[model samples]
Target chain A: MIKIKSIRNKILVWVFLLFLAIWGGISYATFYQSSHEVEELFDSELAQAAGVLSQFASVVDLSHPMIDPKLQKDIYGHRYEKKIAFQILGNNTLNLHSANAPTTIMSNTAGFSDQIINNNLWRVFRLNVKEQNQVIITAERYDVRNELIHEITKNSLYPLTLMIPILLFIIWVGIDRGLSPIRKLAKQIRQRSPEKLEPISVNFEIPNEITPLFSALNSLFGKLKAAFERERRFTSDASHELQTPLASIKTQAQVAIRSDNKDTQRHALEKVVEGIDRATHMVQQLLSLARLEPLTSLDETSDLNLYSLTQTVISELDAESHKKNIELSLDGEESIQIKGNQPAIEILISNLLSNAIRYSPEQGHVDVAIKKVSDRVQLSVSDSGPGIPEQDIKRVFERFYRGQNCQHILGSGLGLSITQRIAELHNATINLSHNPDNGLVVTVEFVAKN
Target chain B: MRILLVEDDPILGDGIKSGLLQDHYNVDWLTDGGQASQALQTDSYDLLLLDLNLPVKSGIDILKQIRKTGNALPVLILTARDATEDRIKGLDMGADDYLTKPFDLDELLARIRALLRRSKGRTTPTLTHGELELNPVEHTLSMSNKPVDLSPVEFQLLQLLLENRGRVFPKKQMEDNIYGWNKEVDSNAIEVHIHHLRKKLGNDLIRTIRGVGYVIDKQ
Candidate 1:
């Protein structure tokens, strides 16, 4: 749960803890083994001292035993040697003894024993001598033996204890050297501005473990640059398209204001209204198309009968077709169903039918057919209108692309593009073709909902 | 003066045509670039008002075609594109003037007058020959400090001859200046207009060259 923000600090803490744990383990192991070896050697020396005294007692005369009370001290002196003691007994009475031996009998027991003599605990070894009543005992102080064990343990741990800080310093430096590339990368990113979207290319060497990080960052920059370019072009195109209408409105208003003749002035004023209408329609269309840009899918959808939907759209534009004197008819299956958002689909249908009526000659016929083609619903609108040129058909879906035949036609030129987007959202396909009358036949195929 | 106005938008083109007619500049309006290009190749005009974004062809391409053929008509680009690069491209390709869209109509008319005056080798907005003065912007004519009342055709014909000063124009050339694509002009329309113009001003102002054409002699 501890949050270490710095990468350097995280690595340093974990590595330092590992060093401490390993140092403690090795120091404890050295201390344990040395103490065990010292204890075994000292115990065997106690038994051997008892054995040597018994041999000397058997070889020499018992009644004239050499009582070397200061004999060992006279030969050599050591702090630990002063704690060693021995005695020989005949009939439970003291006979021969070392310089450090007790004046009284140390032990009457037949084997090794720990005893308190004169308030000092000693490790005593007893053995039988040459005669029936002869015995020898060897003893060393218990506290002195423990002191020797601790001394050996302390010496073994001294070197390992000195190594811990040196290892800590080395680990800290190694982590810093390994993560230097990260600091360089952060500095490079901090220096960047939005206008500069070029991919990052570092000069220094990068390790293989972090190579994917740099490559991922560069790839993201590439994607961001492409998206920004697309948005910029869309804005430029929208402004250019909008400017044409605004220019028309301004020019017509100017003409109306400047004309002296009543008829010309009235006609100019009417055209000013028309220009305003056209500009308003253009902006609305641009907005609706822009609103669809970020939509991955429709938020709400319902299963609707295509026949009824097309009929409803046709009625909505009844006045438009009536003014143009175009005969609009609907046919095919009556209750075929498809799933789509109602408003979006309504715009698509309205655009298509209006376009048909607008382009058809006076009293020309426009037919709409909806039916189930295999598992899909097919909706087609055919008109005896001027069709797009064969070469221009490819560009018909482009925004603001008015074809050669449609040059004089009053249009915002974004209808087909909007329809295309709506079709994309519904997972449908729209096809443009020519009928036998050399007019346009637009067909949209949608997945039929059972 | 006659001017060819090429614009793709229906409302704007109509408005410009009406405004140009009000100013007494015989105007032929076209809604497509290809038609404008064909018209430019086959006809003559005093000035061209061109829109860059068109259906069949672009204004830049039409300008290039006209310049390649050595047609020296004054071209003014009227476009919705306001980018510096677009303006530079239009001017560097032999366009005499460039105006961005949403512009004032008065400014457009002024620029047209300046370009026409420059093309006629005149430093001022008014054309003068001796005691007669013609103001293109006002579409007015004055002689000897008195205003002269002349018909629009008579005024155009007199202004054309006066702007050229020493040049002689045949009868066929005068019909193009006085009428546009749809107007039906009579055979002796230019002569009758000149007769009216001479009667209003003076006899020596416009003189006939006999077998050649009509010429308004320089001072």
Candidate 2:
């Protein structure tokens, strides 16, 4: 249950444990087998010893080895015979015995029995010979058989216990060798500079288990390179666009400084102010567009009425439309709900409305419509102005793209691009279609919240 | 000097035109490349101030056309594009010089003067004839060691005839150069300026070619 954090340690611990378990099983089997063989061999030896003694008693013909069963009590009275290692007893009497055996009979009747004689346990066996009317009592030390079994089992187990530490060291070294590729990869990554976005080549001698890891990391590096490239291009293009108006401002300010007449100086100063305003607006638009790039989704949103939002944006641009005498009118549904962030959606609506107003000619008409088509809420703004040409429409959403026809119009050329981005933030679809009646109709569709 | 200014930006073009007028040079400003190209072809100008970015046509194409036709009209590229490659392209495409936008008015005037001087195959900034010295940058005329005070038109008339010493200019052409297309001029305006120049300097400096035009002899 120890939570090993390192792969090397985990492998080492697991292999060591498996080795110990297998060794323990094999040692147990060996000991069991050895013990079984020893038991059979010892029992047979005891029976053979008794057989030898029985033949010896048949031939000796000494004082009738055991003549009376009543004489065993008299034999127990002889304490001096306790030191004998063998004994012969018959008919409940012991007539002859070795010094290690008890003077009394071990058993009155037995084939094989375990007895304590002179404070030592023995394996005793008896054979009764009816032809001689005698019993051959043979006993061997029981501890001797156990001691032999113990010796064989010890030989089998001693080597396994002594080898545990050395085997652990071998396993540890093996795991370290196996994980060297990972260590090499870590060192390579650590030595790399932060700006090194180039993809790492996977043509190293890495293991098969982590080759996928290298491929995934390389793909990430590729993505990072592309992102950095995109960011560089964006900064370059943004600076280029910003410099144009700044150049205008600088030129006009210098002109004002050198102008001898009040009228020309006033006019130059006024233009300088206009250029400042235009630059400021362009900067705000640029920041807004830049901010929208990293937002994958909106965090705070509500079910907004698309009709009401359009009305609000129209009212905000009332003065601008009035300057051009554009007849701005709203149509279709009074209320249609869409899920979106409020400020983002407001910017979207405002950009569209202002773009329409900016492009519309004096006394021209602009139509703002809100419609709920199935599950989608659609907002369309149409203007009676010079619509985009067939070729320019595709690039209309590119930053700082002012159409050839739109060059005469006063614009920073970031309006539609911002509008498109805001619409994208809301997961809405924006479309631009050329009107046959010499105008443009822009439609934005959002999924209905209801 | 009469300068043809081609710029798409309204305020910048107006400021440039106004600034040029204050320097006593006749200036005609057009807002786009197409109009400027047509003017370059049909009209005469001392120099062309061209903007690179325009609606109908780019100034590069106009420059290519002028160079293709072997016209040595001095063209100065005035643009908002400050990149090294853009400037190189503008110059290599037969532009006399290049100037990025938001430029100093003084530097613009100095470059224009230099370009005009170089176009006339002159290295120095001043036009000289015998004992008369005309400084275009300072807008001054001197007889021997004394500076002469002359009106703007008289100064222009003297400068035009002096720059092209042997060539004779008709009354209409002189009038056109004295006053750009933006202005209305009296029919005898050039004669009045010539008479004023004669009175201020000497009658022998500018000659009347007996109903042909005015000319300054090569001294």
What is candidate 2's lDDT per residue for B1-219, written digit by digit as tens? 899999887767767887788889999888777888898888899999999887788989989989999999999998776678878988999998988866888899899999999989899988889888999989998989699998888888889999999999988888878897878898877877788888988788888898899898887
lDDT of 2 by residue, A213-246 (tens): 8888778878887888877767766876677778
**Residue A416 error, candidate 1, Å:** 2.0
- Superposed model 1: Cα runs more than 4 Å off: A5-7, A44-169, A180-194, A202-219, B66-73, B216-219
How big is the positional error of residue A375 in model 1, measured in Å on the Cα after superposition?
A: 1.8
For candidate 2, the chain B TM-score comes to 0.97
Highest-DockQ candidate:
1
Candidate 2 chain A weakest ten by summed lDDT: A77-86
Model 1 local distance difference test score: 0.86
lDDT per residue (tens digit) for residues B1-219 in model 1: 889999988888888888788788989999888999999988899999999888789999999999999999999999787788988999999999999988888888889889988998889888777778888788788888788877888888888898877789988878887797678888888888888887898798887999778887777
- Residue B133 shift from truth in candidate 1, angstroms: 2.9
